[model samples]
Target: MIDLHLIGIGTGNPDHLTGEARRAITQADLILVPHKPGKSDLADLRTRIIAEVCDDALIALFDMPVRDDTLPYLTRVDAWHDEIARIWAATMAAHPEAQKIALLVWGDPSLYDSTLRIAARLDPAPRLHVVAGITSIQALTAAHAIPLNTLNAPVTISTGRRLRDHGWPDGCETLVVMLDADCTFQSLDGDGFDIWWGAYLGMPEQILEAGRLSDASVRIIARRAEARAAHGWIMDTYLLRRRA
Candidate 1:
């Protein structure tokens, strides 16, 4: 049976890697890296992280297949996952004796990432092990040096799509938004809500802005665009809350 290690490398910072993550990389027989077209920089970032942690492990790199977004939402994702599984199978088949394989996961695997689910589709599924890393939320809060929620209050985490469709979550004073290509804060009716936003958390090019949503919405949107242009990519998350 193939032993697979799904190691979370945290956000984009090399320092976020834990000692356990370091050990996993060193112990792996073959480490797989994904090559994404039009995004060579992202792959480079992954390579840099691996280089810092794994000095001697054999590295295997392969092209990542783009999911056809045209198909029905769930169906498209499912089909894309199947293709990823096939790609992995092909990559591993070349080195059948490589007992320990590792994939560096961005952020925590159990959060919104699908790496774990994709691995499940592999025929004769490999024995999986997860090494948890700091999540984007943790990085965001750490960058800002603010607690995620007010003393003992609850926090609800949701995606941008859900925030736009459902509005603020019920029964929760704090809302943390992620996976937002569109700034969903503008869709809200401008209540007394306040926002603490960060883009590319933990990276040197990180951007942060926080204030009453009414005052900061436009600035955040403009800054996000500017950062994306400068870095060629952006991953942002925001926390919104109102005093009860």
Candidate 2:
């Protein structure tokens, strides 16, 4: 039986690794790193973290499969995850002696990450352990120097697709959006709404923008496009507040 540790590394920053996460990495017998063809920066960051923290731990790199866009969303994701599980099984098989294996996840594994689900598919399913790390929401809020919720008020957390489809949620004045590549905030009415937007939080390449939704919308769209073009990828999150 394998002892699998899913450790959160936080958003592309080695400094964000918690002491618990560091200890787990150093103690791991084998660490698996995923590589995407065009996203070398992501894999590089993980490699650097291991190099800095772990001593003489065995490292295995696996190619991550791209999800098919033609299939229905949920179906595509499920199939992609199954493929990843197969790859992971093969990797683990190669290291017959390794009992403790670790995977470094971006941000928090529990928040908007599917590593846990994928891990469940392993045959004889390894004993699972989770080490929590800083989430993008915390990084975004901290970058803007703003509190997540107003006094005694509720806050709603959602995805870009949900926001675009459902508009703003009811019963909450504050909303935090994630996994939105499309800038779904554009779908909401700008009246009385303020936005705090951040990209690459906790990293040297971080960027921040905030103002009335009406005033910032266009600028944010342009900036996001430019940044994505320059970096070949972008991960961002934003908080929106409706003024009372």
Q: What is the C-alpha lDDT of each candidate?
A: 0.89, 0.93
Predicted model with the maximum lDDT? 2
Per-prediction backbone clash count: 0, 0
- Model 2 agreement with the true structure over 9-98: per-residue lDDT tens digits: 999888999999999999999999999988889888889999999758789999999999999999999999999999999999999999
Best by TM-score: 2
lDDT (Cα) of model 2: 0.93
Task: Please provide the root mean square deviation of candidate 2 (C-alpha atoms, Å).
Answer: 1.0
**Candidate 1 per-residue lDDT over residues 1-244, each given as its tens digit:** 9999999998889998999999999889998999888767778888888888777778889898987978987898899889998999999998887999999998899988999999999998899999999999999888888999998888899999898888878787899999998999898755579889998788887889998899899999999999888877789999988845
Candidate 1 local distance difference test against the native: 0.89
- Model 1 earns a TM-score of 0.96
Worst 10 residues of 1 by lDDT: 187-196
